[model samples]
Target: MSGPVYFVSGIDTGIGKTFATGYLAKLWSEHGKKVITQKLIQTGNVDISEDIQQHREIMGMGWFPEDMTKLTMPEIFTYPASPHLATKIDAREIDFQKIADATLQLAEKYDVVLLEGAGGLMVPLTTELLTIDYIAQKKFPVILVSSGRLGSINHTLLSLEALKIRGLPLYALAYNLNDESQDAIISKDTSEYLKTYLAQNFPNAQWIDIPVVQHKDPLMD
Candidate 1:
């Protein structure tokens, strides 16, 4: 077809987008599909932390189609803030054209490409454009990842609303259990509640529960 599946933005940052993307990539590769993972925009790259390196190693071990190092990981800002702010501090600007060009290039090379966004859905990459807006224009079915926490219900609902506003196709919604303490109470209950809400509000959205794991490799499953 056109290319591999694309992962879309979420309601907020630190919601395990990278972890979820790596897991999906590894899972697809295990199924014998040639896959590639792209950060799209990575910040706070200080000597390649374990998180970033793990993705590279997982893709390599899985025998993915292309070299992990060659994948598109642009907008390497020093600050771990939003892309716009991070770039501003360094007197740099994010070139949406360059990011788009790289993404399309990877789409041409791989059977399944896992594209990861920097932050939340409304996080701005440029003055005029948000990540979600760009992904909507691409018209790829989104695999939105959310957390199981106090405000997950609201966050998930708002995220879905943003997608609807942008007219993006949502493939699924993955409720990731990133925090263990929250699992027994907040995590479990919130997920159930969100599942019900999504069924009634966004019937087309598939709800998936990603089990809590100790390491990044768990995501590969």
Candidate 2:
């Protein structure tokens, strides 16, 4: 049987999505689950995916065979922008089939695959397709990455509404502790408000706390 693939997205860019994904992968692996991470589409790089590299560093497993074979990073663009703009600038369209095939390959061997997206849910993968649209098509449950930074409540709720509108399954909301606001009151209140909102709206969804850590790659200087 094929394993489940969870799409990891954030409320906004720089909200610690990559960190959350790596943390979850490491946590699940420690608890004895064969977990692997996949970058849905990597931007701002050529030949190698920095996000995937960071994930390995955080997981402390270096690189997997799949990563070496490019199965985990199927699509990469040269420009540091959303997929649509990056694809436009690179004069190439995203090969959706290749990505799907890669995910299928990873799911076949791993217990769970954490597929991380480029940015927020509404980020466009193409002129006609948004990130959330691809998630709906693949039917992958979401593990949204959020934090207690200022304006997080509005962003998180809006992201949640988009999922609700599409009837998507929210597997969990990964609260990143590394990106919290400097003001303690704001951070604490944001946490409580989001928790109550999740309880009322997505009652079955899990709340995962992603702790702060310094991920250093032993191989890198």
Could you say which candidate leads in lDDT?
2
Q: For residues 4-87, could you state the per-residue lDDT of candidate 1 as single tens digits?
A: 658645656767776777666777778987667776677776433334455665455632333344345644677777777778
lDDT for position 209 in model 2: 95
TM-score per candidate, in order? 0.84, 0.96
Q: Tens-digit lDDT track for model 2 on 47-70?
A: 888999988988888889999999
Candidate 1: count the clashes: 1
Query: Any idea what lDDT model 2 has?
Result: 0.93
lDDT of each: 0.70, 0.93
Alpha carbon lDDT at 79, candidate 1: 77
Clashes in each model (backbone N, CA, C under 3 Å)? 1, 0
